[model samples]
Each structure stands twice: as structure tokens, then as C-alpha cells.
Target chain A: MLGAMEVVSPTAPPRGARGLHRFANPGRFLRLAGRALPWVSAIGLVLVALGLVWGLFFAPADWQQGDAVRIMYVHVPAAWLASAGYMALACASAVALVWRHPLADLAAVEIAPVGAGFTAICLVTGSLWGKPMWGAFWVWDARLTSVLVLFFLYLGHIALTRAFDSPERGYRAGAILALVGVVNLPIIKFSVDWWNTLHQPASITLTGAPTMYVGMLWPLLFTALGASFIFAALVLARLSAAVMERRIRALLAARAEGT
Target chain B: MTHLAYIVPAYVSALVIPAWLAGEAWLRLRRARARLLALEGGRRR
Candidate 1:
């Protein structure tokens, strides 16, 4: 079965392995990320602006929810990014633990706080949107509860990563926590399907057509793309900072020894 | 416009949080780069 699978697979190295080898060096990553920063940031900012404007002013309001429906434009994208960011963090943690990649460790560390922020935004916006619709600001519904747990996971990862004086100790602990937290991702994704909940079922499905109309869906898609790009740019910027920090520490250590 | 209360805050929070996070990262990067340059210059002297 394995041989058959390999035969059917492309001749190229697995994309994941290829990516790991390609940017394993911090210096190489910094050079590439630095070159890409300006373009990525500019495009991200432009798309976000366009998406918000179009979503707020042009997208048709829902017949049911009226102006309140506008919240979906922001809320849905925030929720999407919160989950996506955590996935990135978990992947980075896995790489750090498995390959002992310094860049991966830093990537995981830097992503925690940003992912936490996104999760917070998602929770807050969800509450705001929920209030007008559900007649309450908070619910103990499965979906809501699982997402709350996700926010806490991000917080826990951040705290663990910074808790130890030895950075390596912190990295190992944080990576373990992140890997364990992977259980929550699927729970968050399938909560509505698995349990009774006040939260609505997903309108966008991979196997089925989106329930949203084109007008609203278009702006949502734009905002989702824009948010993703912004997330990428932020992660790259943080990664570069981390690389510089490591270099500075090494330089200081050498100077002290020499003196 | 009553719903504006909810609508405005949602959008504002979404935009502000990411913006603030990105801004913080950028500032840290700038400071780190400047410090590194200073260290390198001092070494050259």
C-alpha cells in the first residue's frame, strides 16, 4: 500500500519536507521574509480596507437580521483566523519538537500572543453578534464553550512559553501543550454538529454550496483573504524579530567573553 | 442606528486588535535591528 501510494504520488519531495529544508536556516529565512515584507504588507492592507468598505456599505443586509447582519463580515473572519492561527502554532510546535528547529521554536513562540489576540477578538465579536440575535451576550453552548477553551489554550501556550528562565525548557513545555491542544480544534469545528447549540450551523461547507448569497459572500471571501494575508505578514515580521533577538544575544555573549 | 452600537464595536475591535499586534511586532523589529547595528558598529571601533 505504501509503495503504491508513493508511485501515485508526484516525484517531487513531500512539500512539507521540502519547505522545512528550504528555510531551515534562520539567515536564509530572514533574507527571504525581509524581501517579501513590503509587498505582503501593502497587499494585505489594501485588501482589508477594500473588504471592510465593501462589506459595510455595499453588501446587502439579511432580510432577517437587517443591519445587525453586518457583524458577520467581521465576526466570521475573526473566528476563521483564530482557528487557523492556532493550527499554525501547533504545526510550528510540532516542527520544533521533532526537528529541533530553532526558527520553528521562535515561530511557535511569536505566534502564541498573536493567536491569543485573534481568539479574543473572535470571542468578543461573537458575543456582540450573539446578543442581538440570541437575546443574550453569553451562552454556555457547546460551540461557544469550545471556542472559549481555544482562547484559554492560546493564553496557556503564551504563559508556558515565557514562564521558564531557560528558553529551551519553555519551548519544550509550550510545544507539548500546543500539541495536546490540537484536540480542541476538531471539537471547535464540529461542536455545532455534535451537540445541541444556540450557535448556528456553518453556512459554508466544503461539500455543499454556500448558503450565503453572492453579494454578502463576496465581501466575506475578500475579508477572509485579507485577514489571512495580514496574519502571514505579522507572523513573518515577528519571526524576523525573533531571529534578530537570537543574533543579538549571541553577539553580546561573544563580546562579554572577549572582554 | 441603535444597532450601530454593536456593529461599530465589532468592526473596531477586529481592526484594532490585529493592527495593534502588527504595530507592536514592527516596532520590536525596528528596535532590535537598530540595537544590532549599534553593537556591530561598536565592535568595528
Candidate 2:
């Protein structure tokens, strides 16, 4: 019996492999995002509509809060994601620092501004909502104070990350600062419990039943989902652009050196 | 709670702020994409 012998030389990395990193690469990220943007835009519009309609008309008004409580649909979620997003960015910064994932730092960079914007929205809206209920536009209450610190931390992350002329240096230092700042997130959560404050404590949590009824909860849920999608779409778009800009700058630098 | 003032502001903030943010993000994305496209065209020529 003649045994069939086959010799195989090394095969190239898979079709998307060399570009596996390329998919992570900005150019490819943009190509993929270009396809995704329209769908995200369409779905975002629908979700916002459903959330608003359900929140405003269909959802029952709270017995205590009446229609004033409908604001929670937006307020709670914005505040929730504001803190959640910082943690996410910090995690991304950590990954970028540790593994130096090609686009990880850029991802962190592009996202801070968006996250900062959300945090600002959260703070201002929280204040507005608080004024009617608490009788003041602002307070030094623990949770509010802690959240303000979180906002400052975000601003710091933005400033520090862009401080250095060398992008790598800026990213590494910012990553370190971001990780250090993660401690504030937990502190913000516990601040209400730890201190007697004007800010309302958590209405929803894991160990106990939620104070909000399903009618109210549903709108809040939809808004939270809508906020998440908005974040994803924005982050994708910004990251794709950042990557493209870097490529353009590199090309120009190369051309200059050649000349 | 006096409902009208709170309700109006709540709805307004909810609608206006996110709309503003969406518009801002869209504008940034559009500008960046346009610049990149212009660069691509220049390179091709």
C-alpha cells in the first residue's frame, strides 16, 4: 500500500487576518461603520419615539409624583450611563496600556469626550430634576458631590490624555490616571448610603424590589437601551474618524520625509 | 409637586439635550468623513 504523502508550506494568515488587525484598524472600522451607521440611525429614531410615546402618554403617572416622575425615564438612565461609561473607558484605557491593542488607546481617546458630554447632561438634568423635588438647584449632598468629582475626573482624563505632544505618552499617562479614578465610581454609588443627603437614594437595586411600577420602569428601560445604542454609534463613528486622521497624518509625514 | 413646570422642563430637557448631542455627534462625524474623502481624492489624483 502506497501511503499518500502531502507537503504543506505555511499558509498565509486568513483573508481578514493580516488585516485582522486591519479590522481593528481605523480604515476597516470606518468601512464597517459606514454600513452600520444607517441602521443605527434608523433604530435610534424608532427607539426614541417609542420611549417618548410610552413615557409621556401610555405609561401611568406615579400616584405620588404624577407626571413629574416621567422625567426619571431620561434622568435615571443618563445618570446611570454617565458613571457606567467612565468605568468602561477606564477599562479600555487599561487594556490599551497593558496589551497595547492597536486601536484601544484611540478608542479611549475618542470616547472620553462623549462620556464627558453624557456626564454633563446627567449632572445638569439631575440638578433640574432635583430642584423641583428637593427645593434647590444644587446641593453638597454626598452622591451629588461624588458625581461632581466623577465629572472632574472625566475632564481630567480628557486633558491629561491630550497633554503630551507624543500621542503614546499622552495615552499611557491618561490610562494610569483613569485606572486610579475607577475607585470614585464605587464611592459614588455608596455615597447616598454612607451619608445622609438631600439626593434620593437608589430606587432600584438587586437585593430588593424596585419602587417604580412596571409602567414607569419600562420607559426608563427603553431610554437606557436607547442611550446605550447612541453611545455605541457615536463611539464607532468617532473612533473611525480618529483612525483615519492618524493615517492621513502618517502619510503626510512620510511624504515630507521623502521630499 | 406643582406638575406643569416640572413636567414641561423634564420633557424639554429629555428631548432637547439628546437632540443637541445627536446633532453635535453627527456634525463631527460628517466633517471628519468629508475631510477624509477629500484627502483620498487628492491622493488619487
Candidate 3:
């Protein structure tokens, strides 16, 4: 099932992508990923473990929400990554569509499932947090609805990428879907301010100081960094596997022809 | 145990979902590498 490929080999550049033609060498990418995977996996997992422990036990509880606020350590990171990862997926899609970068296509494919998982965590944890805070598990507030749309977009990208027998077609279709879904990012970002929603406004912003205390903020930052690294590691591993699987498929094809 | 019911599940889901995905990613990479090795070695022989 994984053996399916396009007329052009996975390693070969697609027609009309001259700008990135020089970096089309798959061997270099495989070698680089191989060297980096071990360090990434080790560091990412350790940081995540440490962050979770610190946030759970050591970090001071909120003066108001108390221990329930501990859920933010997981929820906020998931929410941040959910948005950031989609931005990444969209950028990868743009590269794939514009430059016909095969690696970019593989990257988009790999990022979706992981991105979807993180988004799921965001939604689930948010709902759990809401139960105590808002007296409701689900709501149709702007922030929540927009995030739900983002989740579906991720699912759509995943399904579209695997829907066709030819990987090129799947990649092209998936790329288009990802690019179209890029509009939702800003909506999700400003949803709280755009309307009077149940969701709280952003505590951290690029321009201003965080509204949260240092005691609360540091754990979130640590977990966010840790989870982001883990996310990168997962995507890299998946990309490497996909490339190897393609080579194996090509090799099997050659042997079949020889036989 | 203030909201342990909610907190426990939230923490569990956060850990379990990513861990499951990470495990699957690792398994896929391991399988691909092993199969690729076998195929290349067979070709040489």
C-alpha cells in the first residue's frame, strides 16, 4: 500500500521547478536527518518529561484557579503548536506547489497527522479546563469554532494526501487544500477580541509583556519549547521513513522488471 | 483533589496521544530502515 508512487520517481524533481533544483539530492537530506535524529529525540523527550514534572508539582498553582490551572501547561502548548504547526504545513505546501519540492510535499504530509494530534490535545484539554471554569464542556464561541475548523482542515489535508493512487496527485491536491486553509490562522488568533467570546484574551504577545506571572509562565515556556522539539523530531522521523519507503518501492520495481 | 477528575484526564491525554504518535513514527522509521537494508543486501548477494 505504501509502495504507490507517481510516474516520476520520488527523488526526481518535478517538471518546471528550477529554483530548488540544486537541493533535490535525497542522499544529503537522508544523511543529515540520520545524524540529527538521535540528538533531537533524546533532548526533546527529556525536556518534555522535566517540563511536565515541574509544571505538575513544583510550579506554583494559580491564586484563583489553583491546581486546575496545571492543565494550562499542556493545553497552551498544544494550542500554540496547533497554530504554529499549521503555519508550517501551509508554508511547506506553498513550497511544494510553487517549487514542486518533493521534500516539502513529504513534509506537509508528515506534519498534518502530528499537527492534528496536537490540535486534538488543544481542543480536548480546553474542554476539560472549561468544565470547571465555564461550567460547560463545549461551546460555539469564536475561538473554539475557529480551532475546530482548523482541526478539520488538518484532517482534510491528511485524507486528500492519501486519497489517490498517484502520490503526485495526492500531494498536489493536499497542497491546494493547505494553502486555502491558511486564512483561518488570523481568525483563530484574534477571535477573542473580534467578538465578545467566552475564551480569554491572549496572555502572551510579541509586543507586550506576558500578563501571567513568571512562576506560571516559565513552566509553559519550557513545555512549549520541549513539545516543539518533539514535534520536529516526529516530523523528521516520518519524512525519513517516507523517503526510504519510496526507495524500497523503486528498488522492488527494478527487480520486478529485471525478473 | 480539586478537579483531579478533569486534571488527570487532561494530563493523561496530553501524554498518551503524543506518545502514541511518536511511537508510531518510530516504528515506521525502524521498519522502513530494516526493509531497505534487507532489500539492498539481497541485491548485492
DockQ each: 0.46, 0.30, 0.57
Residue-by-residue lDDT tens digits, candidate 1, A12-78: 3334656566676666677678877777777877887888899899988888888888888888888
Mind sharing the TM-score for model 3? Answer: 0.92
Better of 1 and 3 by DockQ: 3
RMSD of each: 8.2, 8.8, 4.6
Runs in model 2 lying further than 4 Å from the true structure: A1-23
The clash count of every prediction, one per candidate, is: 0, 2, 0
Highest DockQ, which number? Answer: 3
The per-prediction i-RMS, to one decimal, reads: 10.1, 12.5, 6.1
Task: Score residue A213 of candidate 2 by CA lDDT.
Answer: 85
Candidate 2 achieves a global lDDT of: 0.74
Model 3 over residues A119-205: C-alpha lDDT tens digits? 999999999999998999999999999999999999999999999999999999999999999999999999998998999999999
State the C-alpha lDDT per candidate.
0.84, 0.74, 0.87
Candidate 3, residue A203: how far the Cα is off, in Å? 0.3
Q: State every prediction's TM-score relative to the real structure.
A: 0.92, 0.86, 0.92
lDDT of 2 at A217: 83
